[model samples]
Target: MRAYLALLEELERRRRGNSLAVYKPYDRQAEFHAAGATNRERLFMAGNQLGKTRAGGAEWAMHLTGRYPDWWVGKVFDQPVRLWAAGVTGEGTRDNPQRVLVGPPQQQGEWGTGMIPADAIADTVMGRGAPGALDSVVVRWGGGGDVQAGESVLSFKSYEKGREKWQGETLHGVWFDEEPPLDIYSEGLTRTNATDGITIVTFTPLLGMSDVVLRFLSAEAIQGLGSSPPQGGVAA
Candidate 1:
């Protein structure tokens, strides 16, 4: 327990090194607190600029690397962890975990408060550019030892094109950055194969009724609701 707490503090310190400021102090604190909890699912519902994505990114990094504190509730995949980091479109992925997953030390402003551990990335990982077809790019990460970029087993795909590939491969985890089609999430979760793999969904709510949103709110899933709809008007 003591070691886990120490590791958690170290992660917090590294997270704070980012250039962006926390938009909501209370919310930021809440996320940090929740980040340490052992719960498999966490929801951060708040207005924009409240650091929800950043919180998710930080936790995702921990999951990717299997460095989560021992006391944390989140599941840690067996290394080499196969991961799927997606967005509504391929373009949106460039700024989020696409970079952070294999980013440099001086975390860019574009990554916002989310920064990857510079030492953890491999040259081969970055060199593996997005395959012309979204399904072509495979990505993976290592923990407890060094992982070469060429060795990244994880793949990057969009909601539209990778269904076949997603269905074929076994994965360690999935991180959906923005709301993805409900069917994609459903199919993707199955790919993780429960060999004790995990799936994480992070995004600001949009159009209120997306299938992914409904699944996140489902009683059987790792539920969360975060948004800043106009006062008196319900979110779509």
Candidate 2:
């Protein structure tokens, strides 16, 4: 009985300490990851609090660290990537996507307990203005052999900052945690256009058929969504 209890405790410890080690995406998550290969811009539209944000975080973690699960079949970056993960405000980002990727904002000691493994977390730079918010993270990318220094950077941004903040930098990818205004969304897409990088947006339909939502609900995309359950992502 003692051994069994000890084993259970250890498993729980591992699960919390390095959540990424046990990450197993559901059917929809796998489908979303796989869809990234063909679709440059994909929208994961689902109900709020339904793991859409979690999916985005998991994929972002994989890309930033260049550490993909053996069963992963989604988009894979050959080298370490420069990516952005954003939400509505500093607090919203800190509470959701940021937490998902880097663990609890309040608990700096448990930083790597999120989707990105602890050892792979190279460093974190605190963002300005926002209290207890992270500006960016340096992840050790296990970019095998040919790839350089093996480090990738993940930056945090907010839609409230406007589209200009999103300009300038050429990104490997962008993950939008919630529905962004059309213009902001366009700017994000442009950032990746030069590199042929991907743009992934995961959000609920709060805008109710707004431009951003409409873009993903094209005739074909709508048809795809209706016909049987999609594994992940609908091309737009």
Clashes per model (N, Cα, C within 3 A): 14, 4
Candidate 1, 125-215: lDDT as tens digits: 3323343212323322553446442333445566656566458777766777766676788787787766456666666666565555554
TM-score of each: 0.60, 0.87
So what's the TM-score on candidate 1? 0.60
lDDT of 2 by residue, 49-96 (tens): 678988888889889887778888778888888999999898888888
Q: How much is the lDDT of residue 120 in candidate 1?
A: 43
Once superposed on the true structure, which residue ranges of model 2 sit more than 4 Å away at CA? 1-13, 143-149, 220-236
Query: Which residue pairs collide in model 2, if any?
Result: 31-231, 31-232, 32-232, 127-135
